[model samples]
Target: MGYLALFAVGVTKFLLGKNKNEQIAMDWRKNAVQVFRQEFDHVGCNSDAQSLALMQRSYSEYEYFASGRQNVFYAEANLSLRKRHCLFTTLLFDLTSQTEDLVQFNIPLNLPKNMPLEFLVCRRKDLKGRVSKLTNPGNFIKNPNSKHFKLSEAEASSKNSLMVLAEHDEISNNLIDQEVGLVLAKYGSLINLIHVTDLKQYNNFPLFLRAELQLTSESEEAQYTLLGLMLRLADNVAAYRMSQTVVQKCEKSRKQQKQEEQMQVKQAQ
Candidate 1:
């Protein structure tokens, strides 16, 4: 009788803990969406779906909130670009060996078809761990050493805390100029990585400028600033044109990727 009673108590405690954790996650999601909505409104973005309230689980331990196709008609750029993003808030317990849960915000902007470059910039400390976590069609590089050129001196500061890489030198030079570097340096600690690439597994956009931010606080002001920076990055990317040589290279790479994907499907059958 005592053993059965102890088992019942254990089960009750587990249930209570699970409920408590879920409540905390819900609260955080609420606050995050509120802040995000404010930024989207300021930028004249219409949340077509407002899908943050919908929860999805890719695996038992991972859960995320996705915003579906926030359309922004930029009269300034004369382009209609779409914003799609996901927030991965606090992993479930025992999902990883880490002691603390971290919140990640991933924002990707759909790019025009003419852009033919891939770019990645992040703090040196985050490079290895961040690359390891990126899975599947989301993965950026076949081999980091050969595929990516490390632009260690790009930021031009003794205290440079960034590790920059791009498929083309032109992309690294054009995108990471003084203004962009200042925004990145200001919020360097909060940023995990920002990259532009055409290799997303689910290729809706020919390319995308994606930023992954690690939210450490509930300050809407800071979040707004970071969000604004992302907008600036997208605008700058839209304005820049790739050289013909690089464009040809990117087109070749895309063709090869399609061929490999077709081969994999055939093998599966």
Candidate 2:
């Protein structure tokens, strides 16, 4: 009777352990679902059906957040699932503006310690132009501000270079002609003119009106007025085209010079 009681107690202990393990597994699955839903909501997944499909395919297992820690867990399983579906696992933390001053957070987690990362600080509008300037400083310094002027001075101290103006807008023929003459006198290069052809009906109204009036048998007086307007437009278009060609040629020359310099440096090295 003593041996049988001992055996029954051992069996009860085994069953209790198994039940506890099962409960833990259930909790993990539930937590994983919750975490995925929260992340999905944070990322605005509802707006896109494709994103929702990605989430469904990528959410797999919930690894224990941390040993003995209920709050944190490894998103490794979900990340792997996402990778299989060609989806990026981006973790975005909601940080308040004041949080940076108060909290310490690890940057670029999971990346190699030796990996190089570049941070660019600038107004959003200046990003493209600043990048272009870094490649070709002389051509980029058309309107120099205090910051750029300092940069220009540094460049000048290092190398003798000429500053060139950016291509002029050619929406108006008269403006193009004026810019072309100025460029020729200053830089002695053909200026490239950029004529933007706006396709909107309202934008082309003046030209369209003249063409229609001329084609219609409205009156001899109307015909004469329309013809004069058409002649003026033709002259404007011709002038714009010529200026554009000149500017393009100048730009080509500048590019060729830049290429030659690069080749010279390569040869010297």
Candidate 3:
């Protein structure tokens, strides 16, 4: 009788929690769609909620939010989210405290001119944690090499918790100018990483910019500020040009990377 009563209480609590989560998801979807449609001329979104198991009833699971616009600095932009999915699995993996819900933005660009190099600037704290645990749709750096720069040194001196990884020092130095520094200094806590690259196998664009941010705030102003920062970054990347010699070096590195990829494929076959 006692076990049956406890089971009844557990199931009731689960159902109530599920209903609450569904309502919140619906509200979030509505607000997000309205926000993007206001910014874009032709905006589209996917508000479909992911199917969850009985153990996952307490969490929001995965929800996808996408939007796009033409005649802008970027051709299209979209957001994807992954949150607490399964309670038992999460506990088993020891990801209870570590799982800070991920909110990532992918903006594909159609630049009239090409950037000769690719670069990444990210929060140093996420190097071995939240950002690293994510999958391809959000992951930019498959291999963190010598290019992480001396961000460790910068982190020591400054209040900023950011890191830069670039094809060359010239690209990183030029891209992270005064304007960017000011933005980072002010709102550095909200951002995870910003990557400008043509190398993502999932994206077809010649060049694209991706940012992972923690949009936990429900305030409209905070959301707008985050979105605005992303736009500024896209514009900056679109407008940058390196010296001819630096461009040649970047192109050479790209070729070597391609040849290595091809060789790896041949070896696997």
Candidate 4:
């Protein structure tokens, strides 16, 4: 009789322990997503209680949020010291009402409130898998050797020369440093450095081809056009800076040439 009573107590203790562990796991997951949403401001429709509730619920445990043309799936998992937030979105065709392939989007963090969120769609599964690693897209340009570029120290340090760094290639940093060092030796402060990551290799279609198709008068054209316009603006800014530098160089060269000619006439006299 005593043995039976002890067995009952042991079983009760075992069940309680299991329940406690489960609760701890659940609490940890909830806290994680909450922190992520707060940090990234990933919440949708701040004014709508229903939308907020739906987002919380969906993000609570790998669920989908759909409204009209947009569909988003939220997934959260604990990794090391942080809880990773992964959200995937797909746009459904308004005419055919078919869901498109999953399009990768960006979750903006550590930026001004008015700054627009930036997103990129890549076909690379590995890149998609590493979305969590991209906590800051703005800093990607600052770090020449970021996963988005294959730049050498030399190329990265060039003051004003535009450098193209292929993200997917394995280029030696030492070589880049050497080349940039050589440029610095000649043009001390006249070098401009630029790093561009072409994600076309990760896309289903060639980037130019996809861009051409996107320009077609389709419903998604507006989004594509906006993206193109942003890229164009960045290019324009870079070109303007380059043009100013070239003009300065030309003016300096003309002054030097005139001085040399005067010196030659003086020697003749």
Query: How accurate locally, in lDDT, is each candidate?
Result: 0.51, 0.29, 0.56, 0.29
Residue 75 deviation, candidate 4, in Å? 2.2
Candidate 1 residue-wise lDDT, 136-168, digit = tens: 224243224422233345443433366666555
lDDT of 1 at 18: 54
- Best-fitting candidate, scored by lDDT: 3
lDDT of 2 by residue, 162-188 (tens): 232222323232422443323323321
Cα lDDT for residue 260, model 2? 79
TM for every model, in the order presented, reads: 0.54, 0.20, 0.67, 0.20
Q: What residue pairs clash in candidate 1, if any at all?
A: 137-201
Which candidate, 1 or 3, has the higher TM-score? 3
Report RMSD for candidate 3.
7.0
- State the lDDT of candidate 3 residue by residue for 49-121, as single tens digits: 2211111223554343334444244323333323233334444553545444445667776567776557776
TM-score of 1: 0.54
Best by TM-score: 3
Q: Once superposed on the true structure, which residue ranges of model 2 sit more than 4 Å away at CA?
A: 1-129, 133-137, 141-165, 169-245, 252-256
Whole-model alpha-carbon lDDT for candidate 3: 0.56
